[model samples]
Target: MHVKSQRVFTRLTQLKELILESDLFIAEYNLDNIQFVQHAEDLLIPDGKSLSDLIGEKKFRKIHKIIEKSFKVDLRQFEYYLPLLIVNIIGEAILTKDYHLPLDIFLWNFAKESEKELDGVETYASQQQIMQAIKMKDQLKMVKDISKRPYIYRKNILKMAKWYEEESINLLYKNGKKSLGKYKHILLKKRNFIMADRFEELTLNQKSFMAVGAGHLAGQHGILKLLKDKGWKLKAI
Candidate 1:
């Protein structure tokens, strides 16, 4: 849900239809809730610190160079715009003229929380390893390579979804066989279990439509699999 102008109406219509059919509508975060919005804003920019401050000037400058070179996008146009780019890299919804806030805010907060939690216990060696990984010239080259492929909309949506899901899982759990991996595990896998618990409780008592990021839908520890393992039968619509 990257807020492309062409797909906004289509996505809106689909959401309306789903909402009409369900007694309860659950999203990753309740975008319309003011309290949640405040919380997310605080989490994303804690103590009024910018992304550069949180990541450090040296690391941020290096990352900025990597992204600019790899993606060929100029980030000098605005302050705090790097978060938007980072969000895009992580597959979170992007904010655009056609879309509003809160919807695009939660994931940034979630990502920040993951980093903070990891930072609490990350060893200096592990931190160095993560920084090295991020600073690699080819760190984001794979994304650039993938973007070059021709993809027909709708037809390629499922395939793209599967690819993103697998990549997310691998980054968080499989390839993450280190502290960075643990951070990803907390961000996605652990969060999936928590979300599954709440989703299970809600569905048991009422008809519900739960909308989550596509990345949370598959994988061994994904919400759907967790629910299925708990004896709930699942049927794809």
Candidate 2:
């Protein structure tokens, strides 16, 4: 569901209506389970290694400086790394109400027990690294520039959908260095198939409402296409 809305209330209302109409709610993560915390830890300190070990100590310090300058948060005091902290800050800025909270907290409260997490911890960790390597600056800029007239967030989402849907082989970047994009292929295409397989298994005997990011819905290797190939009839509501 690609919601092109500037109003949070409208989006929440639409989401609430869908949840009330559905039997089961599926999400990218299950906030109610222990696995969510496990995934969070894996992203911040994978395999019990610090952020400096995953990305070089130099790069980690650079990112730490950037965070300190941009968000006024010092990494030395926080247990988590840059990616998780940036996500929390952006979620708070966009979803503010009296006090700040992680975006997952709102989703957890909204859907409660009906929400079932889909992606494995390893896959989630890999995607977070890929995002941090490639688009962290652009993401932060988007949030900073969000209030400007003629919002481009929805347009950028559509453009990315087209790129993924067509399976474009353009070179991707990691921390300002160009790469062959192999990680994206494995993390995105393979994970789509995995999610599709799980979705099919989940819906074999009952109705289910699967909610994934927009990028996972329209690609040639996307979950929706994978499910359709397996003979599941889908109709957008």
Candidate 3:
């Protein structure tokens, strides 16, 4: 117990340095104010039950009928995971309407053109593992809830576009954190910590330009704060 307490204390002290110690640093600029445009997507669990098991028998039947008529898909293969299907379909539709090549592709291309070594903080496999950590039932519930919030989805997309235009990192951070809520621990903080540690290591060897999802730039545990804690200087450009 004493040893555990010591470890906890050490972690808390480090966290304090990242969050509260910035007051003493004159060179630290607010990276959260820089608005960057980006995009991200979530992974769906491969395993799911029937639509009736997920939603309800009557509602599932009604929804399945509607979906079949509309999209002509035989839902039996996916009926068990109706929530996941619904959310994914909705997400794709929205993204399609506003779709362009992902910004990261351009960034990657630019880096290649510049003859810079390319690296990623985490691999696609690691990201999948992180996403798989979410409870499947909770994932279903979240998607179902999201499906009911069309206005919120529209609002979020508009907010993202506006933030990108204005370079409002703080507003993007605030909204993204709110949207993730409890899951932010997995989706944002954990990934941010890993990325920050890797970034610190890379910067030690050479100057590097890191482009990541905008959501990873804000909040207490965000990469900017993590870098600042490591004594890296941040300048607003």
Candidate 4:
């Protein structure tokens, strides 16, 4: 089903109230047991002799020394390599390259999370490197920029819905971690909001755009069952 939106910041009901009244809506981006990260073991591949391998104890120990030595040689220049290695180690958790997050947030986050010690108190990168690395259509930028700056990055979500493909974004939020719970709900709402934005593209008439945040759409029940139940003869166009 396809659920479309009207305005950017306005509540979706202002655009289409009947869409919610109909509950038998089928939408995309529903959260099923996709198993993104099941067991901690799943995150670890044997570091035998491959890029995909997670180096065992001996190799793991050496990484610190290698990075430390690299930094000693030239701390300022090492940032490029550091973030790359960090992203590699974290399994490319960032959704996309264009995710619009403040660079400082990521720098602080990586230092705290991975090493458990914040490094580079006040350091950033050359604009050259940042612009160079920011490629790959920037889905990560989409989320990051969204979270960091709502007024500026909010519209990107609408653009994403317009140009979407089969590979819809999958957000992995920190639900059980700190104040991130509230933020997680926001992310879910944003996810649903995006689906709703792209509702008109679903192809099926009287369609529904399913997404992660049922809560956001849950309250808008008016539109959910409005189509078929009301005998609108919603069809596959």
lDDT of each: 0.46, 0.49, 0.55, 0.30
Expressed as tens digits, the lDDT of each residue in 163-191 for candidate 3 is: 75566777877887887777878888888
Q: In what order do the candidates fall by lDDT, top score first?
A: 3, 2, 1, 4
Model 1: lowest-lDDT 10 consecutive positions:
116-125
Q: Distance (Å) between predicted and true CA of 135, model 3?
A: 1.3
Alpha-carbon shift of residue 224 in model 1 (angstroms): 1.0
Point out where model 2 deviates above 4 Å. Answer: 1-10, 34-63, 78-105, 113-180
Worst 10 residues of 4 by lDDT: 170-179
Candidate 2 per-residue C-alpha lDDT over 192-232 given as tens digits, one digit per residue, 9 for 90 to 100? 78778877767676656665654456557767778889997
Q: TM per model?
A: 0.51, 0.55, 0.65, 0.21
Candidate with the larger TM-score of 1 and 3: 3
lDDT of 1 by residue, 62-138 (tens): 65565455444443332242343343433322212343433333332333333321111112333234333343223
User: Candidate 4 at 159: error in angstroms?
Assistant: 18
lDDT of 4 by residue, 125-233 (tens): 2212332344422422332233345433224333333333322222111111222233433334343444444453343444332322223323222222333333445
Candidate 1 wrong stretches, greater than 4 Å: 1-15, 34-86, 89-182
